[model samples]
Target chain A: MTTVGEVSRPSRVADPDEAISAEELQLAARNHGIPLEALRYDVTPAGLHYLLIHYDIPDVDPATHTLTVDGAVARPLALDLAALRERPRVTHRVTLECAGNGRALLHPRPVSQPWLVEAVGNAEWTGTPLAPLLREAGVAPEAVDVVFTGADHGVERGVEQDYQRALPVADALREEVLLAYEMNGAPLLPQHGAPLRLIVPGWYGMAHVKWLRGITVSTEEFTGYQNAVAYRLRRDADDPGEPVTRIEPRALVRPPGFPDFMSRTRMLRPGPCTVDGRAWSGHAPVMSVEVTTDGGANWAPAMLDAAGGDWSWRRWRFEWSPEPGRYVLGARATDASGRTQPVEQPWNRGGFANNLVQRVEVVVVAE
Target chain B: MTTVGEVSRPSRVADPDEAISAEELQLAARNHGIPLEALRYDVTPAGLHYLLIHYDIPDVDPATHTLTVDGAVARPLALDLAALRERPRVTHRVTLECAGNGRALLHPRPVSQPWLVEAVGNAEWTGTPLAPLLREAGVAPEAVDVVFTGADHGVERGVEQDYQRALPVADALREEVLLAYEMNGAPLLPQHGAPLRLIVPGWYGMAHVKWLRGITVSTEEFTGYQNAVAYRLRRDADDPGEPVTRIEPRALVRPPGFPDFMSRTRMLRPGPCTVDGRAWSGHAPVMSVEVTTDGGANWAPAMLDAAGGDWSWRRWRFEWSPEPGRYVLGARATDASGRTQPVEQPWNRGGFANNLVQRVEVVVVAE
Candidate 1:
């Protein structure tokens, strides 16, 4: 029931850097079509975006917290959280995307909450490598899978939403696989998954669990839904069939540089106006963004920010003109591999990969 | 600490049946070493044994009590409890055993409230065949699992316990698989898994889910703990080296015709008195139950019951002269397959398969 104007502009916007009040940010997130009440959303700023982890948060108290690393290993260990914190730590800026991001566009559109292209976010995370811990646990190279269990529980869609999905051992021991305890230089906020979380970079957000509790190193693949069901994508161009296990790198194409539409009010003549937007891809860095004002016939390149994180979305802006009438603005984003956003997205039972070129409508006034 | 007499004989017990008063039964059960308080026994009758289902009771309004059968079938159908009740009904006498019953017997004896062997009971159940519903649903012969989900949530050992377990389609569609609407030949009791429950005869209590909600037919096996972890048992003879799935049936043995010690007091003669005990096994019936007055050396065969459930224990008895002396009475139950209870149960990280020859100490009276 909220109008576009009401969404794009809120009465108050919280400054992300300023111990920003959550109350205002909540309203702003709502205005911008984001759900801040879903889980631990400690630092989910209004404009910066967010990620939705499919797993329930694990409850761990300081007194009873211990991480066990065993299975196909030379040694087994039970390390407490405090002991784990003593290990060398690393920090990295990365983006996590829920496989179901933009999934609302799929046909027969799944029976879950409809997402509106915002279940993706970038953050600087700090944690220790799970690889070293596995090494310490004496995990054999022959290990096949790593299972993560959280403290959260509930029944979702007739499924026992107990422990989350398990990842392949190869994925588990990745150097980038962090047993993260902090986000954006701050202790994890409860809503965004506090205490500890697992970060699997370059994969859908569902893989990175929030409020992580138990880590079981195993010798086989754990194919439960979050990994096997939720993060799935179409297999190939030929088969519009059922989705496969893996997800490919894809980007989102938004409107040109966060331009203000009100600026066009003073312009009497049909002249050039700056159009602004954002672009982000899960697998690779954004290479370029293109704009198509005359539908899909002709395309023009837009300027993009060069200093953005590889996982972070790139802001893009383009120059466009109106002829005293209605104008439809279109934008497409390309990744490093030359993979470009499609004009129309494929449909699936669960909406995923809905990266169709985005269009914004506007009206120009006559002088 | 409260005295044994005071703690054991609280005058508060709820009874659904008028056969025995609450006060008298509370004193009796306590005298027999049962902890009536820890059970959270809301309604405790002296004659009828207490029944405890693992999951929370589902609250079903008669107006919306419909059971829906869908997927991989000839017809997807929904039947209300009224319709199910009106259908041809059948009744069967069965005993339900919790997977963790006698769990305290495990070595290293996992840290749980030690059980005094009172977690087993038998009841008559009434309901319509689930097989007919499956047949109407057109269940494929190839269907491997029938998963039952319930509406109960509990926090056990810190894990959310919304219960779900899958049974082989062959096992699920059996003639005895009842969508039970009644327990003990009476209208279904709320606390005893009412509304509807799955009664899988011979399987552990985990297989009989309470608060039945939905059943899903699948061609794959469910790997949740209730299926994959809990209820699992290893044969004492099976090499400790192999990892297998099926659980061997076991049984409990109790002293026969107890409280008879006072009946023989009229003789006014005391030397060395002994009492006989009973034994039961889950698989292969009760081949033999031996009683030992001197630890477990001297053995004597105790009488066995004429009729026994496939997975039920047999009552046994032995006698000795009543003298002023203290003795440890031990009873070991052996299944037909030569599997005997060990002096101390095997050790497992997960407290499971705790079947040990029961040991109880008693003091003989002197005249």
Candidate 2:
């Protein structure tokens, strides 16, 4: 274990003018986001879903692997894969977005995973509700926070430990929260935390820990490295930032037509075209979605589909008759809570919770 | 369709000192490579498999999709997914690698997919042999090349067409060549060319067209864009270089210890450790593998496991005892065809067929 003061490489914002460093490129190559065109599918295919692995995927043998629940519980329990499957199963269609989805777009980019609005996916996860399991274990009255630990181990900012995070007792016992063992009707893929993982609905991906192995109920706040040093909305190095929770309002426009091999600029023959995308928010239901043809100078309301699920994204479409010229397309969403996607990015030291409007460049050509 | 003369964007090499451009970063985010740490598995899991899609994954409905085999064949046949699955089925453990696996590492890097040596995966493909299907269709005596076309359509360098590639008639009829519909005991995932795809063993990934929709046997040499223009080993724009075919010999060491969050420099305690990795070659079986503790200054032979399959990667392991220090670990493989991984990157205009030695940096700390 590394002390907080024995830092080797401290976090720092990257120079806006500099190109992506080799280290960022290395992370980008390992982790991937869904192609914008994949928005056509309601439930993202397993392989096309966005993925971010903090460390390595742990080698797990499912037959012998067991998850233990203890600490401040009247009855400690060790559950195997078969035991978890035998319980009442409930499936939910949920949308998960990384807290740092627009990190790279920040003027002074954060040096972690350099995501750009594509680090979000909607999936159908099947598992038993976590509330029932906690009830079966008979949680003690003094429990304030429940910490979930995963098998993936690594050194992040000089701290060597298994990945862990804690949720308040109220959030941990929500009916929608699950100990997910399956994804899209199939057993979890290795990269997706095979055997078991934690799924906290209406929260950023950081709250849903993968490769989950142990759960501990504590009386006090669990201030681990992840909860204390990472995933916080810090304004500067010295400021003790607030913990980042829940997904922010976001809308992404699928790039129209075909993409150029090198530049990825979209091209299409000028004519009647239907532009569509997906939008979601964790704080409240999305009320409206808007589209922009000439960047942000003008905006038009788009038709939103019926609510799919409380935690899932809603489809929005706009009809347009385009001309032969270059255009920058954009999309923004407003939730029932009055939270709206920002036209300009809200810069932070950790680049957390950035929901900047998406802008896609397209070229409409003469037929 | 775009004409050859109406060029929109021409190909060029990137400045050596320039950081990765936004365009390259966009492509990197869309397509992902397997993490080096995933080398521990003999057969890569579906989600962890390296993927490189040239264009959008076409919306494929398995029930309605039909594969047409036409052109110079004596009898034309349009087979649906059910008919193809009913034919004689065989499975092979084969390794597939992208031609531009080490593209980003080239001095003047190619501006396409900025891959950094992780664009390879070995999977078990279940499908019927293409030879029996061609024999049933009755191939024309004068047929010279077989062109396979995929539903993924996009523009590359000015030419717009479905992603297509051609193989010589002799190579197309090889017993190992398959019209695959399954990967790793499961039905193909959407991004992996659901319904059907071609599997050409011992060839670079470009030769194995995905989302396969049509097969046309022609009498003349097929000069398609993917074959004639892309995937070529050109030195300059004017040079009509040789076609890149087989996967070059290469070895990658599974990165040891834990990684730092931003820099990815690994750290571990000083002790004895066993370093292992996977190695393969499309032209021939890997005969020997060597490891170096001090960059490439010295090399020692590693123990190679018995061949797993004719076309699959073989495992190699090396045991080392080290004191506290910094080390640049390296691995290189030599194939039966006398092709060995080059210490220096062999530069090319397309950045194809680069099998440079793998280097990993690690720092040993006192316990």
Candidate 3:
């Protein structure tokens, strides 16, 4: 491990940019132009960071950094990163998407950080469940919200301060939600919220605070800038619809691409190809996924990766022999809660919670 | 140009996938560790495509394919691509944004082809103004809208049909709107609506029809699937907000990187950096751009490229020198209409018309 005073730390990454060339990415998704399929958990086990944050990747030394629990708690506790890690550890593969994952797909597209679907990823998070920590701190009965603050500070909207978010006491005490320090079986990257971060499975990425510093038990409702001003399902300039929470049912079919057409990539070659995708829902388990090549002309079931439990996206695959022609491919997902990916997603000004069907276009040529 | 068949198309590209290695993309944005600066459009003239469309890039022979003007026009006319091109050519640099450009950034993030800001592109289009053609066609006084039909066909939102869009007769007659035949001074690529496409300056990309095939002068309002069911600024499932028209005040900082992180790229070093970006407004000419390196604490005006007329994004730049630290950089734009990009944007069910100020975080380290 490189120390803070090292003359020159070997590049955190051999190549500072940790991205595969579009050509390589397309080659990886060469299954009948199924581009989303290129995002396989086996190949890319770490989850994608849907949001592009340009903050300092703080080099937090486990020896110095500490997580504090205060406010209405019976015992205000402060624990360093290592002491926190020594607690019971848990691991689960979870898929996390920024609430704004498909923000650019909105019609009057918002002017915020334009995010496409890449603002998401699935990963193995190993850390202590949040509930154990909360219980150990003896939450006061009157505490209604659990507020979290991160080490990264910035000026957002108009506020310049550390990133902060709040969860209801109930959610803060869930067994699945963790204070994760390890991602994909390794320590978290600085960009991924190193040393300590909160991983609220089933919630959007915003709820997962990186470089976590403190947890506050609030008797009154928490209204931090991130909680009150941002992340809302906005409607008009003045009307803030509601606070955004939970992931909606969604699926992605990765595909190969031709140069100049990353969005509309085609496999080029015709004939038989296996198509597959990943599906998930924060509200419930992804029950099933159906595929259609000719719009909705036909539907076919796909083989699925056995349940890795809730919060993680499920992998599904199908095979087809498509002839030389233009086709619109689609994937729809139904969750265990009886919620299926809608033909049309509900719209909001803040561009929140759009769980509509994903349609991809492809032109297959003769092999 | 190669014909329908030849020894080979030399492979439109060496590989179908055109993404750069993620590492390289990340490194390119390492200036002072500011990632968003990676979005550098000055280096790329033809902007980016943010839409997800699937259809064979038809190799239309201009000799065979024709543009027909019919419906509520006095003299119905049909003209081949060549005849259309011969009609007084005009060229202008304009920016095109998919109506759903920020859709992925919405709150509950839609599942439809997730589009972030990459759905926008600025290009020099050469074509004849639609107004002259309408005047020649003697548009009936009763005509309310001019409907445009593209030769391309695809299935969207479960509808299998050709791509189509319409403009109010008044809007259609605007000289800035054109029956474009070339982009960036060259015949559009097949995917970019080869042969002929409509270039509706200052309007969302949906207003520009690719593969121009038909222009119908309609006395009544036009309600095609693209207009009625899809592309509408929807509210709830039932509340179709309104037809999305006109480009709002928006600015983009072009950066380099992998396909996914197109909007955010950093400059890794902690030295002097010249930052530049493009701004546009369908509402009016871009008046000015303000940049801030110390968050919103201070704002400095960025030098802008003189107006090249309307519809195209204005170019702006700012130079700065910094020490080692983390910073949140921001860019906000103002238009001739006296409208400035908002700190937060109104949300629509379709995630439409979001023009929030953009903030980019960066980590500046010692050179």
Give fnat of each prediction, in order. Answer: 0.00, 0.58, 0.05
Candidates' interface RMSDs, in order? 34.0, 3.6, 15.7
Show where candidate 1 strays beyond 4 Å: A1-48, A51-64, A234-272, A294-297, A365-367, B1-367
Every model's TM-score: 0.41, 0.97, 0.50
Report residue B30 deviation for candidate 3 (angstroms). Answer: 17
Better of 2 and 3 by TM-score: 2
Considering every candidate listed, which one attains the maximal lDDT?
2
When candidate 2 is compared with the true two-chain complex, its DockQ is 0.54
In order, the Cα lDDT scores of the candidates are: 0.53, 0.88, 0.65
Those runs of model 3 whose alpha carbons end farther than 4 Å from true positions after fitting are A1-37, A46-51, A54-56, A256-264, A296-298, B1-367
Return the lDDT, model 3, position A328.
73
Q: DockQ for each of the predicted structures, in order?
A: 0.01, 0.54, 0.03
Tens-place lDDT per residue, model 1, B52-113, is: 33322344565687677765666777888888888889886665555454544444433222
Docking class of 2: medium
Where does the lowest 10-residue lDDT sum fall in candidate 3 chain B?
B1-10
lDDT of 2 at B53: 88
Better of 2 and 3 by DockQ: 2
Models ranked on TM-score: 2, 3, 1
